[model samples]
Target chain A: MRAAGGDGHPGPVIELNGLTKRHGGKVAVDDVSFTASPGRVTGFLGPNGAGKSSTLRVLLGLDVPDAGTALVGGRPYRKLRNPLRTVGSLLDGGGAHGSRSGRAHLTWLAVSNGIPRSRVEEVLDLVGLADVAGRRVSTYSLGTGRRLGLAAALLGDPEVLVLDEPVNGLDPEGIRWIRRFLRAYAAEGRTVLLSSHLMGETAGTADDLVVIDAGRVVARGTVPEVVGGHASLEDAFFALTEERGR
Target chain B: MSAVAAEWRKLLSLPSALVAIGLTLVAMPALGTSTARRLAAQLDAGGDGVLGTVTTLTVGFELVPFAVLGPVVLGVVIIGSEYTRGSKDSGGGRQITTSLTAVPGRGRLLLAKAVVLAGVSAALAVVVIPATIWLAQTALGEHGHTWDALGPRVAGAVVYWMLMPLIALAVTVVTRSGIVPMVFFVVNSSFVSVTHLLTRVTPLAAYLPDMAGTRMFTAQGPVHGGLVMLAWTAGLLAVAALVFTRRDA
Candidate 1:
């Protein structure tokens, strides 16, 4: 079994302790625990319905956990003085209203969180959406939508970022842009927790890996550490799941 | 400033806001012109009691444009837009609990929504009142009515239109849909008509958001008067605030 212990590192940027979530009587996430720290992109790897979304939702406080606590900067999300500034998140590309222009949508969110209106334009440029920033979101392609989501996430200049399936519909150019942006964002001493079902997309992107299956943590370690005995990140992920018979 | 700013953006950004305002501007003039024409035709027929008929017709006609559709639709948009836009939790389905985990103080966010709705209501009043009044006066003159008698009627319509949107704003927040508030406004208006039909019931129907707001179109005394209608506006808003806090959104 993969080692079940902390990395002997400083306090993690995000800490989950025995986190569990249940919908009705079905357990979506079993007792799970892991830590995401600063200065690296910690990829939260899981297959569809593997509790990745649930875990992120729990982390962001979108859903309450049946047990355990999800913390950010050593405190719960709702208690933060300015949440958008502390932990920027991109949960779903289609979360925004289609009728609203990209800038209008972001501007409202910015205003709500006390972020300056000018930052709306800034993030749009950062995500390469400046050209179509005034276009209504309904006309955007999936890649454009992803860019808009990323722009909103960056609007706060947050200390920590939690992204779910961020690169799902991105083009090669957009993908390359995100890879570089995420790395640079982390290099600046910020915490980045990204979730993706595709191992290939994250293979070259993530420094640390946390693999989950059947709503449980199957493996957690740096990519090299976990892939020590495997050929690739995919192989390591499958080996862990097969070993657990899940 | 924060509240006003937040509310203003929300009201303006909403698709329903435009529809609501459009309905008011278009419907008022159409109805006003039609009433004026109908009255002028009656006077041309040299009907007895034409002056009294013209005076009463203008006030009664205001209901179709302002009292009924105006207030009900505005109420629905104010609160329903949030739900229609799927803005219940932070970032739409991000889960407010999660949002709370991130920002805490979920209450403040909701309060901001309320502030936006309130400001929009006032702005709607400031803009629509004068325009509606001018239209009503010009239309009545075309119907063989002098401007002197139509002035108070036009002013009343303006006041009623202004107050109606606020009430609708509150109703929508509480009900979370335009359909429910629209149904309530329409049903209540029908009830007022029913009361009048059942007994010498004062035109109390005019005092409900739709009925009473008609008085603004023409200074006819609604059943419960302006105080009662103002109470309705305040009460609906209060309920909206309460529902906003209690609900999951």
Candidate 2:
């Protein structure tokens, strides 16, 4: 089994500092700032269009911010040499061509970052996708595709992981497996930042929470601190976001 | 170097690239042989038209231009596949996300892809050009010129093939889809030769990429034509790299 951080190096922190992004003329992420520290699962909680994805996109360098900085390990993602060795990301769907098999998809990604080909099979197995690795992605069900995306994210066994809506399409068992896997991952002193609209699931998995409404942070802290007298994280989430929505 | 290997594998793994290869291999030689046979038959019937001047090199030249479609399609597929969306059940993701995450330097990634596209196009030309010429010569039999006559013309054809795909790749990068470049190239190369027709309307039309590229093998000034085509390829590629690096994935 690969140890967390792969080579025994500690996980790196993900930091977004006053990051602002505009799509057309409207603000998509407005002066957003947060940190997902090493050795913790930071749940980025928001409603749909809450700018959670926009923040993550800037963090990964998939989209440019109009102002401010998003950094991983104290450097921008685009500046990292062999970035997959430092960070792994899951966005949207499988992030694979429909005509490519799951194995083929991982194979090219591995090759690109100079990751060993052996890791391809390892990730496939880790995600319980070894059986269908040869099947084209277009044929995969929603949950299966999510597994493939997770497998790609895990291919490098990197120090940090940034995932968007990771449990959105998962079944109950898959959700349970991911919760356990992520918790154990952070337990090994690695960093994980996952975005979700599902309050209960994030509450169960995240050690810290950063809640955004529209394009700004509404609340951020440990679950207990953010929940503060709200009875539950779910109730806290609704109250925080609903208050901002008004 | 690793990025190049990855891009190469990405291209080869696409079923559309393989299909394009298969069709090019078949179509080039088939077209060469048929053209050669028709010319020979016309010569035998004592009909002097273009057939009266037919030679082995000319027969190959007649068919080689059409082979441009092969590289054009391959070039478009190289970038088009990245933007292709998956089925709704698969979350409608695009491979560009995975690609950017793997190699976050957008300029580096686009350069690697262009290198692979150029290499594949050149390799395809090396294989298909010789095969088509050999088959055409065999079909021409006694009427054909010796293979020695093809030395420079064959080189010219290879260069022409190599450059055409880069042009296609650049256009596809800007458009972010294969449909426009594929239709524009395929129709102009095969159907009516829009560039060829445009030559009658203006002298400057002779300088258009495809029209100038064709002159590399078919005209006397191979160097001049090749340079013009190269300029077009380089300019478009520069614009594409700029747009690609500056745009969001």
Candidate 3:
């Protein structure tokens, strides 16, 4: 429903420069740096416990980085005049209240951000939830909930998308839909930073790949370059993570 | 302004806010009239309107517990619902995450919440008190009315209504749950004034928010009740603001 770069703001260049985050005595994302630029899908691949979630949280300004900056569009997320309009994000299961209808939840976000109600309806329709938008979110299935989260991220028609494990629980059809969606979104010259453990999905959907293990980015290159001499992306991913485990 | 509207809408979304408000508006007048009528004979004969028929008739009925509890409940709900965890094992903690992402500025978000809370509490008092005064006067012989005492008392009711919720809201902001504030304050208002009992041992207890707030209406206090309420409200808010701004969402 959104025109390509509809707001005319160039898709943001997301940068995590020497980013380091620690929880108590343990470090989560340690001195990691990367860039996700416009007009391409940058897949952040990492195994669980590899700190992909923490990095994404920092990137979205959900968690404060202990020692570095996570910048979008040349500024920290909190400094952006309208962050949601610049970067659409999906965090975990999304933060919809159980008591609120899907429409009400989106309505409040729209109100908070000054987005029109018509936009909320359009996002609902975009996510295939317009018919059930009146139902309390407590009734939605897991996949529907994810779609609702995606709808919120898109509410502002942002130039950049930062999503965490977006296809974690989707049906195969839903996963394929998301893959197609991300590809098309990046093709429209908007930045897409997606993290997933599913190598197959990332290999098929992403143009560039950054793989992390144990809170560190160990490899970065195009799909074929990372997969060099390996039969498939999956084999390369395991070999890389296994080599890092040593 | 948008944040304020959003906060108000968020408060309205909760069934608790609407139920608490509706019940208080209807219940206070009904209870005030019935109680005033029941004590009419003793109230009239007992020293010929000694404590002022209006005060004696309605103070016990409309002044504490029920009168203030609903507003107090709503105050807690405004912030408490955000801390409520959802069914998907998604904790209430994420709400702060979502809100911060939406608003970003910690100080602005908290300010919006405070303004909305005050506005809603004041609005509730406006709807409820005039009707309550009318019902009480009708039961006490319908001899027209006296604005002399009511001028201050209604002002006091407005202060009381606004203060109770603000107090509850500040605590909810700290504890991140309405349950504690709702239970403690509702009980403190209705059953036993913990602050009142503590006052016997230490008059300092009288300076606690509720007791000081009661002074607005009763004009009895160990200190200037309004100022005490102001100090406590301002102090609690300061602490909440500090924590909210410093902590990672």
> What does DockQ come to for candidate 3?
0.47
Top-DockQ candidate index: 2
Model 2: runs farther than 4 Å from truth? Answer: A1-12, B47-56
Give one digit per residue, the lDDT tens place, for model 2 in A85-129.
889888977789988899999999999999999999999999999
| lDDT-superior candidate, 1 or 2 | 2
Models ranked on TM-score: 2, 3, 1
Query: Candidate 1's error at A191, in angstroms?
Result: 0.7
**Winner by TM-score:** 2
Clashing pairs in 2: none
Per-prediction fnat: 0.24, 0.92, 0.46
Q: Any runs in candidate 1 off by more than 4 Å, and if so which?
A: A4-11, B1-4, B40-61, B64-75, B78-105, B130-249
Every candidate's lDDT: 0.69, 0.87, 0.79
| Chain B TM, every candidate | 0.68, 0.94, 0.88
Q: Cα RMSD (Å) per model? A: 5.1, 4.0, 4.5
Name the regions of candidate 3 deviating beyond 4 angstroms. Answer: A1-12, B44-62, B89-93, B142-145, B221-223
TM-score of model 1 (CA atoms): 0.79
Candidate 2, residue A144: the lDDT equals 93
What is the DockQ for all candidates, taken in turn?
A: 0.22, 0.81, 0.47
Across all models, the iRMS values in order are: 5.6, 0.7, 2.3
